[model samples]
Target: MKFGPIPTLQAKGSILAHSIVCSGRRLRKGVMLEDAHIEQLSASGITEVTVAQLQENDVHEDQAAAELAKALVPDVRAAGLECTAAFTGRVNLVATGPGIVDLQADRLIALNSIDPMISFATVPNYQQMRKGGLVGTVKIISYAVDAEKLRSACALGSAAIKILPPQLKTASLVVSQNANRNDEKGISAIKTRLDALGITLEKVIATEHEIDPMAKALSSLKSELLLILTSSATSDSNDTAPAAVRAAGGQVERFGIPVDPGNLLFLGRIQSRPVIGFPGCVRSPALNGADWVLSQIACGVSLNENSFAQMAIGGLLKEIPTRPQPRRPKK
Candidate 1:
């Protein structure tokens, strides 16, 4: 792209590089200079203006960005994602359904490293998104770019963004309680969380807070996922919840996460079904480590020690100021 000042009379057919005010009328940037525009500028005493003229091998800014964005999210469309039309060399990707947003962070970084003119940004990986949520966007800095560079950037974004639909739609809650089974508040909180994610709470099993009894309850329940809410947080692999999972013929995948407010969370698998030992943080509606784990599980992503460990980067959920204030004055 060649950009420089050109005389108004000779600026016809060139793209305006900058917005200008002439004769009380605005000629916006990216506007193609025509005979009438040149006449208007000449009449307004503006002899010269800056504009960008594309070379034979260079692509237009909008075309380059649109093509790259299209290449980046081709599969996203079929997965219930919508791509907006390129505007000012930008294209935004929006979600069409509620689901988990998965992003290829490494590939995105590499793509951005290719050239400063081409850039892409997206929401954090594994974010729970509602319909119409902005997931990703492509921005082209210059008015135009080399087609070869555009191609190189697009190649790095293959399968870069994905909206994984919720798969684990049903779950059973097994509460380990030594006292009465009438914990309406606890059950209601769990139910509300599951319902918001479109997951059904199929059964609620209340049993003694012991390995044997909890294991028996787990083995008897049938659901896509099992949630074990122990009366106390499990502190070891041999703790009641983890041991119960083992006794129920399940493997404890991970004991704890690095996330605060959810460091007590435990993960296991029983006969290909996922099991989670809920942390005390889950009793509230605020987002925490358990929400992150549950979102990944609902998206059919396998959970293990590495998965739990990887969450430390953005796991400071307790620091978020979304919690309810007990001492606040009522409106």
Candidate 2:
């Protein structure tokens, strides 16, 4: 019966009444019509309804009280309330307090809904309201995940289910083609040497191929870490180690290391997952990049570029030989 920005305050020959909900589509100055009134309008063949929450000071009823009141409705209101009307232009009301109240109309409308509300309307699907959904991947430089450490981080995310995507699997080896002829051993030799060190095939399985399926498997299984065993090639030689992983048709680069015995070792990722390659020295029980990488894994760190760069300091410490010389008996 009425149509305008200010809403027709006075209607003619109509049992129902109406008021302004907001000022020209802005979410200010609205009415708090009762749900019963909305239902009345619905039954009267009025299908559309829009709701808004107005500030208490909006009403000029008591000019003196407007200063102290944050919002204005004919009456004082609280937060978390909604004012409704059968139409859009005019609104007046202030519904407040907790608990969700039913709001119905002819067609479903998106008045003030946030993100997840209209996903189908956008090109890129909207992010889920819940955490962990569509979260970007994190790369770890370490070779394996420490279950205890990973479990702790999972708890913080409050994720009932954690998933490690398949992009994280990597290869492990005791020797590298990156090293000199004397130092470089094939994958078989590295495995054999590790076998001699009391490390069993079951403890760290070997793959005929360069990379292992376990990395992919663990990631798909939401695994938090991947452990890779590798041998160092040479120290300070400017040589690099082989790629930790390569897609079925991916590229491989750098084969030797520039460090000491730890030089031949390498650490890299397959699918953006963390990877740690142990040098031959890991077999010696001496401190090395492998140890530091393992510690980081145990701490559940993602081998992101920044985290990888931070390992330089620890790697330098590994190069130190603090072997204590036997002290002669004091006179």
lDDT of 1 at 218: 94
The digit string of per-residue lDDT tens for model 2 on 1-331 reads 1222222222222222234333233212233345554444445544544332223322221221221111212232322222333122222222232111112111112211211211101111111111112221122112122333333322332211121112212233323322333333334444453332223332334332233443333233222334444333333222232332443222222233333435455454545434445555655545455544444443334444554454444344333343221123337
- Model 1 C-alpha lDDT per residue in residues 254-307, reported as the tens digit of each score: 888898768888888999999988886677777788888887887788876677
| lDDT for residue 113 in candidate 2, whole number 0-100 | 26
lDDT of 1: 0.85
lDDT of each: 0.85, 0.32
Model 2 whole-model lDDT (C-alpha atoms): 0.32
Query: Which residue segments of model 1 deviate by more than 4 Å?
Result: 177-189, 318-331
TM-score of each: 0.87, 0.27
Angstrom error at residue 205, model 1? 3.1
The candidate maximizing TM-score is 1
